[model samples]
Target chain A: MDKYILGKYVPLNTFIHRLDPRMKILSMILLMVAIFMPFPSWTFTFVMSGFNALIIFVLMLISKVRLRDIIIQLRSIWFLLLVLMIINIFLPPNGSIHIIAQSGNFKLYAESFMQTGKVMLRLIEMFGVAMILTATTSPQELTFGFGWFIKPLKKIKFPVEEVSMTVSIALRFIPTLIEETNRIYKAQSSRGVDFKHGNLKMKFKGLIALIIPLFVSAFTMSDDLAFALEARGYNPKAERTSYRVLKWSTKDTIWIILITLFAAGIITISAMHLDLLRHFFPKIW
Target chain B: MQIEFKNLYFNYNNNSEFKVTVLKNINYLINKNNITAIVGKTGSGKSTLTELINYFLKPTSGQVITDGFISENSTKLKFKVVNKLRKKIGYLFQFSENQLFEDTVIKDVSFGVKNFYPKDDGYEQKSKEALRLVGLDESFDSRSPFDLSGGEKKRVAIAGVIAYKPDLLILDEPTAGLDAQGKKEIMDLFKKIHETGVQIILITHDMNVVLEYADEMIVLDNGSIQKYGSPKEILKENVEKYNLETPHIYKTINALKEKGIVLNNVTDIPSLVTELKKHG
Candidate 1:
């Protein structure tokens, strides 16, 4: 089983990896808000791009995660890019003659191209920031951060400990579940169940045979887990203590402040519609 | 409970062209309250035989009867009876980590017990006692099982089965990758558990464990029973014929025999050590 999917936290002593997870999570949200702020002018997009590029460059240096590795994670969302591009081609135009028609009415429209480019860029920025956040934060740190963030909800009688426990278990089992599914697939295939040699409907029905056993095994595992938990004398009502504490340092505060300022600037510029900001922006190509 | 397989023959996916005939005409009787070690190389139907005892795989022909209940040849017996029979037998996997899925060690260990005895009143207490038996402290109950070491994880898995309090315990390679200290701890735990009167059937290739713990040993070869007798008798007579190596003590005795050093039977390490003292 490859342990890479649960963020693969390499535990480097770099600045970004050492940053408090709570601040890093807050910064991630801020980055997303900055990227999505509505803007008719292209300047905000250029500024957002510059900010994202700086983040990627700094994160790569701190985490030492190869650009190729991050790009591999992006490949999973390729279908979303295709869908956005198709939607862009049919979207209503804004009186711009951006379409270039070539022989026999085959045309490439500027509005569609620009819309697709903007959507793709935004998607990449959102996912890239998320990937960076996860790569730098260990599973324990992320769970503790979640627990800390939700601590205040205890006043409202929320089950924060239970919620965090569930989240941590889910995170831990994601790789295990993937391995189980692969094993079940191979086991069935070995017993003369060909998963790929059938028509659409036949293949769909065949998948049930695979899925049923997997579900059965998962239920068995869950039942076992419940028993193990009870045997360990776990009390859901008792207050839980963590082994690792989430400490917010000076560097974390600086990171949070910088991200907040960057987000505020983007929102303020978009609101004001400044002419100087509009001229320096690059047109969507 | 006595487990007996009479002329059992099994082939997986029998109707297909790629069918694998795993076992054929196997005959064996595992006596109750005694440790039986099944030794075989890979693909010798050892796993298949154990699986048959649990009814995980039914024989194509012949019968697997255990504790006066027919487990595999259930055409004559009802399904409910077979289920009742299986509830008495606990099967431990080779890779113990794969069986652990609970968030905490206690919960993972109590999984089998909860399944078998759902209506029991003191389930929680039983679970705690099982964990204690496995040498895990109470402080570890609430901790995430993912944080546990490999040997600890294996112990937790064993604790799960132990909590069920089954009549028969079947373990497949329980000490595969443990260090010397870990192996001793686990083997001693097994010995303590066995002394409490539960029948233990272990499948292993470790001759040292077989010599130390097993009363009877069965050697499997190419889906057939190659040898079956008391461990001492088999080790004394035909250790070389079966291509199975004896323990170091047995090899030393044999070496001494070639050198005209006459000694009474030295079957185990301790006995050999005592005999060497006589010469000194």
Candidate 2:
């Protein structure tokens, strides 16, 4: 149950952990935009992904986030990766300029590898970007960061603060719900729910037994949490004051400058079709 | 059942960066025929120890032996043995009312009985008897447990547990979150069940309940047992030093002693009053 690391925050005082939450959010967006930059050439896409992966790798090292945790989070997208590979293998999207393997009418194309690798790497890059943001920044910081970003929307009656609070509260509930599910599973299993060896019908019965009670508990907990929020003076559509006044430091300005330049470099390189690896290794390309 | 813990150590997540040892190395053999109370502050691994006994949790090291059945970290316990062990010991978890899911109270109460005795035709009768013992009447049998009050739902959940007639009952904060009246009723219900030859081991924060009901007490602090003895014997010691406030009756006794009126064995109000009357 603890294996998941998608929205879980690890409390470690590191360089990445110390960065302003707003800066982290901004950096993640810049990197994601760079990874998905408009580059039609397969080689360029792969090169861009490599750069994004390198950035993510550095973040992981600095944040001391474990690879195993990231890989476990990445497992969710493995099936889509597999499906992309399977589809691309039979029907190459990049063109069958170089035939890698052929059996009867079935043929493997080198270009298929290009397309699959491009997509697979981008998926991993994006997942890594999100993971880095969530793992380093606690939900409270993330909520405040998000609110900082959307503060302008409050002028248009967007309920910006409420949205941020809802998002952070939802993120917080993920682990609580997981723990609740585990407890319910243990409680039911002890009552002889035979989930392991039960037949299909028996398993269905066991699932119903679990689901109803879990819903009840979840609802009960949500009510309690709502009451707690109310007791703490959380009101929707009310003028709220900031509890944590986190101001951006010089470090945040430096991060912004670096990320803007990186974004510009990605756009320039993609527009110029300057994929140096493909340019040097013509035959390999 | 002869329960023994042999140097048991438990971590919720072992072999991980987030590893936290919940139970430390300790060994104790529970005297089989006592109403044992395991009391500790929150996060002191009180619930973990009870879970270990029920085989719901496997220790990270050493072994937990209940009766002749043994659960070890390195080995897989057979389902037959696990099922047998679980049936012989009914566990009433904290917020047990949340475990209720049946459409009606009777079916919910009979859940455990049905599980352990699917072949027995008298499971419904057993459920009714259990409900009666918990002070819920026949009208409650048809009502949805979820529709009932919180205290009633708890009673229904407890009834489900005792319907199976386990050799031992393990309660984790059975009376927690209840009103004084509700707490008294539930504790008295356990006493009635205990008289039926079922040994009870409860994890509770209620020192008064421990003094009034428990025959043996284990004081756990930071995953280690600091004292193991009868309630009177252990509660007489410096309990506050172990992250526990002294029970109110004990505080009263001490205050009277300071006023030159020392009382012995006066751990409860009734006993203190009786002792005071006798002294006069």
Candidate 3:
């Protein structure tokens, strides 16, 4: 459970931490867009992955958050990465030729293997960027940044404040829900629900034992929290003033410039007619 | 089952640099069939102590010796054996009402019984009997646990444990948040449960509950055992020292004794009033 480090902000007095969260959020979106900007070739994918990793390493150094902690946070998603790799492994290349057994059509192309690695690397890069954003930004700042970004939508009568409040509450309750689920699971285990044992059917039964209680308690907690919020004069429509404002610093300006340049570079690369940037599905024989 | 702690130390977030030691060098023997009440202020390791009983928490340094097993770290125990051990000890968590999950009261109570003894034919009857033991009759069995009052929900949660019929029953602040009558009813139910030869360990701040029901008392201060003795002796000697409020009867009795009245030490209100009558 400690491995599941979602949105756990690490307080540090480093350059990355000091950057405005709005800039951080904008940079994260830009980086994500660049990462998902489909690579034209396997070589480009590998090159982009290396570039992403290098950028993440630099961010880690500037943030002063331990690389070990980031790795631990990444461990929770390793299974998903493995599954993606496994799925890619069995798929035949676009123009596959017979490698070992032509009768069974079992063709193994070197390009396909590289393609699998490329996809896995892309996923890792995405997760790495997400982890950085969550680790660097506190929940309040993250939500505030989100609200600020979406502030333009309020012109269309979009109820942006209510939307941001919902998102913030949902984000805040994720860890709380996880904790509550853990408690209910333990309580059920104490009552002889052998969650660690039994076949698949029995395990599902054990899960019900946990889920029912978790829902009941979650509802109760939400009720209490709603009351507390109302008591504190928290109205969604109210013009709320915050204690700490996100100031735009020089570091934010520099980071924003770098991300904008990176985005421009991605678009420029996509427009170029380089052979290395073209998709290549080599035939295997 | 006999429980013993030898030089126990417990720390939270044990692997982190910011780890904090919550309990230190705790050593005590909790004998079977006796009601032992653990009293401490908030954050004084009372809940942590109860967690140790069911092996929910492992000691940071020393051993928790229970029955035929000794555990310092939770990972050392075999998974199946841990479940079996847990089945034999009922734990009523603080604010136990939150543990109720089943749609109906009967299902909630039967949950533990069915889990521990999947093949048992008399689970429904036994669950109903457990509910009855907690003073909820069959008429309320079909009702949703969610619709019940706070005290009723707590009772159903307790019945969920009682249905399992564990040899050792550990309750954490069982009477908390209950009205006066509700508190008394729950305490009387606990006394009745103890009378059935089940060992009871209670973690509470209510000195009155401790004085009236507990045969032995353990006072905790800053995660260390400050005092352990008979309730009468511990309250008389170390109540002020431990920064605990004296029960009303004990306060009056002590006030009279301070004036050289020398009335007999009594735990309950009726007996203390009778002693005062004798003095008159």
Number of the predicted model whose DockQ against the real structure is largest: 2
The candidate with the higher DockQ, 1 or 3, is 3
Backbone clashes under 3 angstroms, per model: 7, 0, 0
Q: Cα lDDT of model 1 overall?
A: 0.74
Give interface RMSD (Å), model 3: 1.5
TM-score for all models, in order of appearance: 0.52, 0.89, 0.89
Chain B, candidate 3: TM-score: 0.95
Candidate 3, what DockQ? Answer: 0.60
Kindly report which residue stretches of model 3 are placed more than 4 angstroms away from their true locations once superposed. Answer: A37-44, A64-83, A93-105, A227-235, A262-285, B238-243, B257-264
Q: What number of backbone clashes does candidate 2 have, counting pairs of residues 3 or more apart or in separate chains?
A: 0
Each candidate: RMSD: 15.8, 3.0, 3.9
Error of 2 at A231 (Å): 6.3
- B159-203 in candidate 3: lDDT tens per residue? 999898999988888888888898899999999999998999998
Estimate, for each residue in B149-191, the C-alpha lDDT of model 2 and write its tens digit. 8899889988888888888899999998999999998999999
Is model 2 an incorrect, acceptable, medium or high docking prediction?
medium
Q: Model 3 misses residue A269 by how many Å? A: 4.5
lDDT (10s digit) by residue, model 1, range B183-264: 8899899888899888998998778888888988898887889889788877776565555677777777878989988678
lDDT (CA) for every model shown?
A: 0.74, 0.85, 0.81
Candidate of highest lDDT: 2
Predicted complexes: DockQ each: 0.03, 0.61, 0.60
